[model samples]
Target: MNCWKTINISRDYGTLRLIMFSSSTVLLSFLFYYLVMSTIVQTTEFTQFGFVTVVLSLFGLVLTHKLLHCLPIWLFGGRAKIKISTRKLLFPLMDIKLREPLSRNVYLLALFSPLVFITTAGAVGSIMWPQFLPYFSILTSINFGLAFYDLVYASHLMKAPKQCYIEDHDEGFHILIKQAV
Candidate 1:
């Protein structure tokens, strides 16, 4: 196999830029989702959870989003190592390292699973329980923010050859293609 390209989005785009993009995504998604849901469900009742509860719930959402990324790979018989650690002694971080490369389609599926699943569930929940729309919208927006990096990685992968394989590395990911004889 030939190494086609190496993509390190954080390095290429800069961590600050990526963080800014993700912050914007969270705010914009929340605004858009809240507006749409509010119109659909004309209820003025908004349930507010406690500050500690909200923080813990958001943390759980982040963990769930990370697990969703691994779900597809697990189903495809791939092995991954998940590391959970704390950043700044407060924020939790989860890193998943793949034991083997995956086909372009499967890798894309893994990258997108969190966004699709969480967003869909949030939408459905908001519609069913309008009073919790704020919470649902916040969770969904946060998921989208977390998925910003995944979306960037997917764009690069999508441009690679369809037969390519994606391998995660400490830097980012390596796109490999089979050599033609």
Candidate 2:
């Protein structure tokens, strides 16, 4: 069967949702960090360089996050081919594509595993040094934004029958439903 009509990433995630969610997440992150989490922050003699390092770690977290996301893909018996591709200009971006089709639960697990693991670590670190709450929250918020696409895809997958196959492609995913013989 032709899988062309199965999943269209562009149509699924259009420009409207992009502008709305991106702006909303940033605004909410600032508000939550200041209004809610600001109380938990403990004063410290954190140096500018220290803050600089913390900020720089966000970039490292991008790689770490991707790695964590791939753990399930590999453990669950899927192909995890890591590749580096350039964006609009010379900016490089790293991606890991899965060649195997994953079950609904497995796909969701891989999609959200990073969020749970990273957020928990951030929480522990925040407790050890509350002064880093702002950075942690901002980075966490950005991670959530990055995972938004997966969340939307998961929602789309929910429409499929219980016994369905989901393959991760460059544009998005192709959901194949298995029929009872």
Best by TM-score: 1
Candidate 2, residues 1-106, lDDT tens digits: the string is 3332244434256768776897687577656754565567665644233767876787788888888888988888887877878878666698878877778777
Which stretches of candidate 1 lie above 4 Å from their native place? 1-12, 87-89
Report every candidate's CA lDDT: 0.88, 0.71
**What TM-score do all the candidates reach, one by one?**
0.91, 0.81
lDDT of 1 by residue, 89-158 (tens): 8666789989998899999999999999999999999988999999999999999999998999988888
Question: Which whole-number lDDT from 0 to 100 does residue 152 have in model 2?
Answer: 72
Q: What RMSD value applies to candidate 2?
A: 3.4
Q: Using alpha carbons, what is the TM-score of model 1?
A: 0.91
* Clash pairs (backbone) in predicted model 2: none
